[model samples]
Target chain A: MDVDICGPSIPTILGIASEQVHASSTGWSPIYVQDNFGVMSVGFMLPSSRDAIMWRGPKKNGLISQFLKDVDWGDLDYLLIDTPPGTSDEHLSIVQYLKESGIDGAVVITTPQEVALQDVRREIDFCRKVGIRVLGIVENMSGFVCPNCKNESQIFKPSTGGAKRLAEETGLEFLGAVPLDPRIGKSADFGVSFLDEYPDSPATTAYLDIIDRIKQLVD
Target chain B: MDVDICGPSIPTILGIASEQVHASSTGWSPIYVQDNFGVMSVGFMLPSSRDAIMWRGPKKNGLISQFLKDVDWGDLDYLLIDTPPGTSDEHLSIVQYLKESGIDGAVVITTPQEVALQDVRREIDFCRKVGIRVLGIVENMSGFVCPNCKNESQIFKPSTGGAKRLAEETGLEFLGAVPLDPRIGKSADFGVSFLDEYPDSPATTAYLDIIDRIKQLVD
Candidate 1:
């Protein structure tokens, strides 16, 4: 089934189509593009094997910008830029360059905690000042559920609906929370998305809803 | 043949004795330490199969201090430190830490060029400020032997005896010159000191003379 789309639907369709293409290229048939406007990722351009280049500062920034400008994006509806850790040169270069190249918006990911949340707020402020629309916030690692009691325990204490409060305080939409799951970490470690690995998992369900919200916001 | 003696030559004696111990530990015993006092190096602690943890900045500084403080000196004489490129944190941390730890002076390494020679003067100035004795300078990569003509070419374009010029300018002893040799790089690559690999080479002879001069300084 071949379908063409534009606008906010572009990122989702491109993500699905890219994954199917990648899977099929590795001689894996029966891989189909599903979810017309739902998926989001930055794994499409990564090498299948270990030829990963490691360098310091300016070198890393140069490589990332080269990827964005030179790589064939192939008609993206909404290009999502997944960033590396830390507020460093690479992060600064990517955010500013992407804005210049004209991105629809950005989804800021943060674990629920005072430390990280504070950093996230600064990043959001920076984005706004630079004229980039931040879609919303995704508060990951919100809480962990005890298997025996089925009661939720906050792993990073001093965090409960803080994302919501911040969103409300800042006049931005609150995208809810994602529970802490060991499986999510494991899936990422194995270079597969958690949603792709365990579609019915609680975390995946949360991500699906977030995607739906994004669709509504863009439409 | 194992020989051990103590005094101002403790680092040098330790270095010499370690050659025997390192030889005994490994079946092939080509590694020997000749104390060229004041010459800074991280090569002494490197095991046969590992690359020296050469990096830039505070981390590298920390590692140098650790190597000095933690490593077993045993019944050795002189401990020479081969510093990394420049007159910054790596060099400062090394000299200062060694002085604080009650170690001897520093041997500044430079080539016969105005640019490098100028930096060497600053390094000497830094050492004087920090109260580390200035032993002298070992001019390295001074010249190259022409492959076809067999005539030495000043490949590095040495400014007509840089060591002598620096010695006069800074009023410090000018040790000697180490001619530019491809074998030095080759030996370093193979984790063998150039002197150990090519003991009879002119470069090795220069190192031996430098060692003798170092012995005189320490004694």
Candidate 2:
């Protein structure tokens, strides 16, 4: 993946894949590189490997400890981790471990809905309690476009214009919203990045924008 | 099936296949029958058709709401709800919703492991916070009998004994421990009751003990 560094594009030095990444070369390379770069430092290996614990935690502080001590992550610009939804052992484990691991920031994802917004608020509170700064909120599945009507609708409804409201009330930076797109799910279902597959799609554009915003905040 | 009430043996209702019952009875009889006389109330219908929630939170709450209001549960001596593992969204949703839904109390299930125990403690705390009485704790998968060694090995290291220690320390009730039984999971998978299939099994005895304990507490 080519990440924009300033105006010029550079090959991604590291990538964080989801739990399903273990099956693919695209996900493995980041781990392989970090493994090979052991002499540089500690704590870098965590962002790279799709560790079994990374995908499963509630008391995964042990796994995160191993991640910090075992993997050699060279100095990098940013270490972004995409997390699974819902508060469980894995989610708590990751959050607690990240604070211990010295990661200072998080980007919480939510959709535009009262229920989801409430959950995101709780997530933000969780990050605050652990002393991790929430960089921003990314609203996914913001709105669905109708093919027949050429009108937008809330697939997850009563969520119309909720992202903006959430940002204002929570005092969090409004990163961006990703419109509901069928292609994103289709590509993600196969472990492929939708941005990589459909550069022109609105969802891909939103991801790029989010990536840009993430760089600005974390970089 | 037929639950014999007046026999020497206690009649345990494993589950009421309301769908099958309703289908067979031409839908004249309510799907949920409380005791043996009155019609089944709406408190008994579990939305068995919905896809398992991938995102967890709202969907889980939705399930709890459906279980509470939509199910036609008739008069019953005890209502036992089997919950999913961990303090994740599904677990939280049930706990929080049930706290407000006029539920009498809850039984915490745990394995004999530090990790699982930690989560169980969190759940107990959550129950306390929500003002839901902790009826007791059930330790599951405590010990496994080694086939070759013919010795009991604590594979999951049974949570009940440790739970008892924690209960001693915290003043919580240690209901009892259920040993690792392959038959329990097998019976559940096959949609049968372990108590029915293996009435003399140690696990079945434990389950009966649990119900007895629960009856004592809630009654």
Candidate 3:
């Protein structure tokens, strides 16, 4: 479930912002997408796409609890919760709510730059302190491949060894790196999966490889 | 004062993270910088540059309130508080604490893209709802200039008329646009001012023009 309450971009990313969420007897029902992936976000409840969620701590925590307890999410293989950037309130709320549910582990995604890695380090520490087993680290936007020339460039220069180095430092597993593809952004804007659109892209290959690693770890 | 509690980038941006915050009888004193600017951020309290603040809402609100009330900020002409993205707890807390200070409105900074403009729209609405007057809007990363070729490219693509258009739609003043210069990022990374480094750059000129506009609005 997409729980980034403040700026829930999942519906927009999936091109289902127009889809209305229903109120079931149990709680709120999520919008079902392809592959039986049920999605619930504040975006679904917002009056308009441009509306901002000006909520305080209590309100946010309450909504998060509701999303967890109220949402009628049935049996699923995996339920990925996308959070906003930071190791803040949302993370705490999610961990607290899902404590008994056996939240498999967290897959921390980060860019290669030190500025981003600094936060990721803190995220790792947070998980450790909170007793959430970190599954692995995934370095996104690792490198950029030019469309015409196919030449690789470090737009967001991985100057500090990226996620692999971070994994090594923290003794966590390093999943893989997803190169920067222009089509990825376009795909997100168009409400389509870049993996499906550009099957042959390096990012897709990296994703598949990472998924394999995750399966091995989980299994 | 940079109010972004989770990830305070001001100290890093200004290259003053190493400076220790002083505890005074009145309150905590801010670091004095050039141009008589008194800077205070959560970054100063951090143990290391790479450290992350994994705080929830209550802690964040407490720190923000402390920054506002406890900081021994003497009389100042202007006190710019750089907040993190979104109009959530931080914004609300700041507004609540500084309600009697006669806040001189806000200068909404955004990039030249619908994706960014969408958030800016929400921000404008937030200001209106809270009764915080918006000074104007500044469109950043409007265009990119190739260092080698000197050819300007709309990397961010101001396709939707960006901030100016949004200002027009919302009946707010369109301050100006700051072009995407590689030096700007480098300056930020190096903890220096881009305006000081690239005095003649288009961005610097634009900043000057925007400042003039702001002066007209305020003075």
Question: Which one wins on TM-score?
Answer: 3
Better of 1 and 3 by DockQ: 3
What would the per-residue lDDT of candidate 2 be over residues B1-219, giving only the tens digit for each residue?
Answer: 111101101111223433432423223244433345333322123232111112224444554565555545545555555554333444455555565547788788876655455456656765676677888888887665543344555544433346777677557888988886655544542335678799998888988998888888888
| lDDT by residue (tens digit), candidate 2, A71-156 | 44445455544443434333455555565558758788876655455456656666666577888888886765544444554544
Where model 3 places Cα greater than 4 Å from the true spot, the runs are: A145-153, B146-161
DockQ score of the complex predicted as candidate 2: 0.02
Docking class of 2: incorrect
What would the per-residue lDDT of candidate 3 be over residues B87-178, giving only the tens digit for each residue?
88899998999999777889999977565676788888889889999999999877655554555555555556778899898889999999
Worst 10 residues of 3 chain A by lDDT: A144-153
Order the candidates by TM-score, highest first — what do you get?
Answer: 3, 2, 1
Better lDDT candidate (2, 3) = 3
Local accuracy of candidate 3 as per-residue lDDT tens digits, A1-219: 776777677886787878889998978988987768889988888888777789977788899898888888887777788988777888888998999887788999998766677778878888887889999999987765444454555555555677899999899999999886556655665577878888987889999999999888777
TM-score of chain B of each: 0.68, 0.70, 0.96
Model 3 chain B: ten consecutive residues of lowest lDDT = B144-153
Best model per lDDT = 3
User: How accurate locally, in lDDT, is each candidate?
Assistant: 0.53, 0.52, 0.81
Tell me the lDDT of model 3 at A71.
Answer: 89
> TM-score of each candidate?
0.41, 0.43, 0.91
